[model samples]
Target: MLRLFAALPLPPEISRPLRKLQKDLVGARWRPEENFHVTLCFFGELRHTQARDLDELLGEIEAPAPTLSLEGAGWFGRREPTAVWARVRESDELRGLASACERAARRLSIPLERRPFTPHVTLAYCHATLLEDARAWTERHQAYSSEPWQAGAFHLYSSQKRDGGPSRYIAEADYPLSGFTAPEGMY
Candidate 1:
């Protein structure tokens, strides 16, 4: 079985700025630079053939590359914080890409958690008692903004846990946005 998800990888230009926001949060396990991405849809695990089929279907998507922007910061849990993330400015183009990915999951008969699509790049997972600290940190960095850039493509990634080491995420395939030049015809 293969564990996978679809995501938009952040360019170095954008990722550099985001790295600065990772500091000053106590009791938080910050994510690595290689793990930074805006997830479109998460498909936990699938059979080998199922993964191949999904990859084929995902490559057929043809949306224009959307210019993405970052704004503010927030935590996932309300009272007891569990995660800290940088918010993505919402756009119809972004939503369309996410919806298309969700549709692809459904077509593959993958059961997905039904919830409002909230797009954000998670920065860290925090201890539960740090709610106050998380909020204060959020407020301090509320005016944050990153230079907008075009999302040239989306990727399928596998999140693997290493023995006695941090979980590492690896990109398995890339599907370029319509109108973008696909390197070596990789779709």
Candidate 2:
């Protein structure tokens, strides 16, 4: 079995600013810069055959890349504060792509969590972080924003855990969107 998800990887231009916001917070395990992404759908653990079928279905999705930006910082778990994240500003195209991911899963007869999609790039996971401390961190970066950038592609990722460390996400497949041109200096 493999843990899989669909997500849009952040370009360097957007990630540079996010890296700056990773300090002065105690009890937070900051995520590595390379792990940052806006998840479209998480399919959790799946059998190898199921994963291959999902990958093929994902490749068949036809949609334009969404233009995205980060607007503000926030935290999940208001009481205990489980994670910190930079909110992704939503657009019609973004929602459509997310919906297409869900539709693909439905066609594969895969069950998904019923939670509504809240797009964000998680900055850290709170480990015994105080509620007050989490609130303060969000307030400090309330005005955080990133310049809009068009995503060239979204990917099917397989996550593997390393002993005593955060999970490493590996892109198993990439599906490029229509009309995307690689920005200069980016591959």
- State the TM-score for model 2: 0.96
Error of 1 at 86 (Å): 0.6
- Models 1 onward score TM values of 0.92, 0.96
- Which portions of model 1 show Cα errors greater than 4 Å? 181-187
Error of 1 at 30 (Å): 0.4
What would the TM-score be for candidate 1 when compared with the true structure?
0.92
* Residue pairs of candidate 1 with colliding backbone atoms: none
Deviating ranges (above 4 Å) for candidate 2: 185-187
lDDT of 2 by residue, 78-117 (tens): 6799999999999989999999999999998999999899
| Steric collisions counted per model | 0, 0
For candidate 1, write residues 3-104 as lDDT tens digits: 899999988778878889999988888888878899999888888898898999999898989888999998888778888999999898899999999899
Please give the RMSD of candidate 2 to the true structure.
Answer: 1.2
Whole-model lDDT values for every prediction:
0.88, 0.93
